[model samples]
Target: MANLYKLDILSPQGNIFSGNVKQATIPTTSGLITILAGHTSLITMVSKGDIEIMLEDNSVKSFTVIDGFLEVSDNVVSIISDFAMKSDDINDEVIEKAKKYAAEQKQKNDNVPSEIAEKNLQKAIMALKVLEHNKLKRKKRVKY
Candidate 1:
């Protein structure tokens, strides 16, 4: 469709996704931004949050983006994230454990950098939020 655009999402681990999507909603440092096919060409820093992508078939896929940069140009979108993974691929238990670890370390008793500890906690929280959102979406589908 004319409204769809090519999207590429990548991280150090590997390419997360590459396909045509009807639209994409990303969380930036400023706020949430929704990009369509004809979005203005620009780049911005993405915050820790879920990236929701609506595919050409209207099905939605979500990924957790810890931090990154997003670019839009010529009807194509590119996202390069420091850390990212599919919602389904993430383990909530592991994230929760990380959150606890960060919280414990945040006390400054272990002499760990508070910034790093805080960042880890924030990432774990964001990942959990994305996982929760995905679970709710799946539940809604089952009700239909």
Candidate 2:
């Protein structure tokens, strides 16, 4: 049997996941990094990307992390994120509506804060990307 490491993933709202995982792939500012058991203790800032975790059952779970930090020590990895959610948590319809609303607001309200608009746009885009990735994976599985 493969060794397992503890992975605790947390969002600003609360803890999302905590379990024994075989591996975890996180997106750092530089690039994607994969961690396994016996990985060195370190800390790094995570980018806006997917965090893929390989579970003990050989299933892969993905979470979208907007901006966050990760700490690894003693075969335990902890992730604290500004925002984090499983790919399944994002609804395509909801994201589409939010994108449309942001576009309308950007056009109608000149007083809207640029930062707010940017944040909304980024979130909408990220949600769409996650949804699309899941859709493609489902399609591929169906074809096989």
TM-score, one value per model? 0.82, 0.88
Each prediction's Cα RMSD?
2.5, 2.0
Per-residue lDDT for 127 in model 2?
92
lDDT for 140 in candidate 2 is: 100
Runs off by more than 4 Å, candidate 2: 100-112
lDDT of 1: 0.87
Best by TM-score: 2
Taken over the whole model, the C-alpha lDDT of each candidate is 0.87, 0.90
For candidate 2, lDDT tens digit of each residue in 1-144? 458899999886888999999999999998999999999999999999999999988899999988889999998899999678888888877698869988988999799999889877988999999899999999999999
78 Cα displacement, candidate 2 (Å)? 1.0
| Model 1 worst lDDT window (10 residues) | 106-115
Best by lDDT: 2
**Residue 36, candidate 2: alpha-carbon lDDT:** 92
